[model samples]
Target: MRMCSADLNLLEKWTWNSRQNATYAGDLTSDGYMSTQQLAQAWKQKFPGLLTDNRHDYLFKFVNDQRSSTTFRAFTEGLFRAQEDTYDIAKETDEKLLRPYKFCSSWVKNVEENNDTLTQLRTFESKQEYKEMITNISLRLGFNYDIQKELVKHMYQMCRYNKAWDVSQISPWCAVFTKEDLKRLEYAEDLETYYKYGYGTPMNQQIGCTGVKDMMDFFKIHVDKDTPQQPRSSVRLATAPALLLALGALGARRDSAPLTADNYHSAVALARRWTSSTIAPFNANLAAVLYKCTPNSNLQINEQYQVLFMENEKPMNLEECRVGLCNYTFVKNRFGLIADNCNLDFCNSATKTTGLIGFTLLFVFITKLL
Candidate 1:
């Protein structure tokens, strides 16, 4: 582990790669983020006038805005637009980096078939359409981040025999991965302390129960047969979504009673409360409370659960689901997941993926630079 940590020190730049979880370990393995900070700091150091937050925001907009550009109208379009089935990132990195990964032919074929599906999602007219898309993905693929979060958190809570078993989607608190530092067997106590203090606020009444290093321990036990049928749903949470899924699974066995319609509503209500009322960010524990209450065999809640999913089988917006008298069943009118669509950030919210990617990429780049 010490040797691997040294190697991460050598690599120079990277970020918490969700696709390659745990491989990076903790404490920002790469310089991607630092590069941005360094650049920001440098700019601040160079010009005091640009230090203001609003100015920085304006500068960010000006860089991307064509109206502020001196170049021709078609020039900027060509910059961001893909050319000849290749993106700018692809072209730039194609020669410099020997691309180690490529989608299999089968994956591409599936993508081709789903082109329209992607188009619908891309051109989704409203929030309702987007939420419907989320549901469709969950229903068909058994991939709802919320349900998956609930289940994984349950797993960890129920089966968390040790600190190694705790972890939910992309744990920032956990150490970055090192081939040598695969397991912190020596400093398990410190790891546990970090978790306890780092994730102080509880989601599913659990704190410091997440870390990337526990991935190995999670696969060894929680993944064995006879486990719940929907582990794959963890992909939706993106980072901690996967960890939370495992945690949800581990946490469930700790449940005092099985989730049912009578108690399930409260679980859902609690989940809503955690999400809305609490100051904490999203986590698997919150997810567990919501789905754990989902009656396992009771068809009433289960059937109603189906409606919770979109036609495509994806998850729905939790905030949109009102606790008082909101329809637990699907209500649609040509507008694609209409009832689930109203008043959502997913639809109108812009900084959905770009901001995250920008910061993460910068973090990785800076790691390399440093």
Candidate 2:
């Protein structure tokens, strides 16, 4: 059976209210999908000052991209519009540079689509701790027997979303879970993510090298003496999975050993580096800033330095350089394994064509026999 982190029913119920609050009453369609116009209006409501100068009619035209059905594109475009900048569709389309995981068929087949990916997650659900948590939640709700896993899961998701959307007011659903119980549930989620997206699988990190390479290439261009001094920025938006992959590639907050169901009890002590809430939470970000240092007697001319930040905070120091600033050359040398050969690394060309060739040979043999 396919497992989902959140219940669809709870999502529909919660999302409807959130979307309604953002837009007009009855703005959503029967299927709960919003039109481009309604989406733009919702964006305007969320950031009232963002589009003050732009005309309302022009806003609709800007966000209405028929090629993509999802509102994600519209939201991204809205951000660029707010900043008076153009969204680079071409750069975003460079899948090899920005999203190498898309080319990794092995990762898709072996990890993502594979049932074994959730082995630890399934194991955790069957564990005594997990069962007791469910029972306790059911008892809290005044139920005689244990509540269905699906219902409890939905409750947890509702609790999480309600708190995330509005932090001041606690959700009624959250009352069922105590502080300890919430921690357990959160660990369960961490297990799933660690295996599916984080360092449990090596390919996840391998594919993430594309983003690392892109960053290095950008830094190299600016750090070069021949390169002109100008204000430059590289902004790449990606999902949580991609973010986790990139983090794994950078060896950021990596545990000494992989997190598994067997070690669930010792997670706090053993897996200190593998916390999903801190590493890849809602709207999580990882950034690398390059600074040109002033030439002192000890420092070379045009000396460039780099610093890494996660969620707007400097979490750790680079071993190769000083506590805050890492030399550019050292940083690039460390990530030298990340080459511009995503297709070679990710795309399993031989494996992909083997089945087709075998089938064609079989067909030819049968034709000769006939």
Error of 2 at 67 (Å): 14
Model 1, 136: alpha-carbon shift in Å? 52
Tell me the whole-model lDDT of each prediction, alpha carbons only: 0.23, 0.54
Q: Pick out the ten consecutive residues of candidate 2 with the lowest summed lDDT.
A: 361-370
- Give the runs in model 2 whose Cα sits over 4 Å from its true position: 1-91, 226-231, 267-271, 295-304, 309-311, 316-318, 321-324, 340-345, 349-370
lDDT of 2 by residue, 129-245 (tens): 889888887776667799888798888877866665556655666666778887787778888889888888877777777767766666666667534222243445455666677
Q: What TM-score would every model get versus the actual structure?
A: 0.17, 0.68
Top candidate on TM-score is: 2
TM-score of candidate 2 against the unseen true structure: 0.68
Report lDDT (Cα) of residue 277, candidate 1: 10
lDDT per residue (tens digit) for residues 266-364 in model 1: 554234211211211221111211122244454334322221211011222333332311122322211122212322222223222211000000000
What is the TM-score of candidate 1?
Answer: 0.17
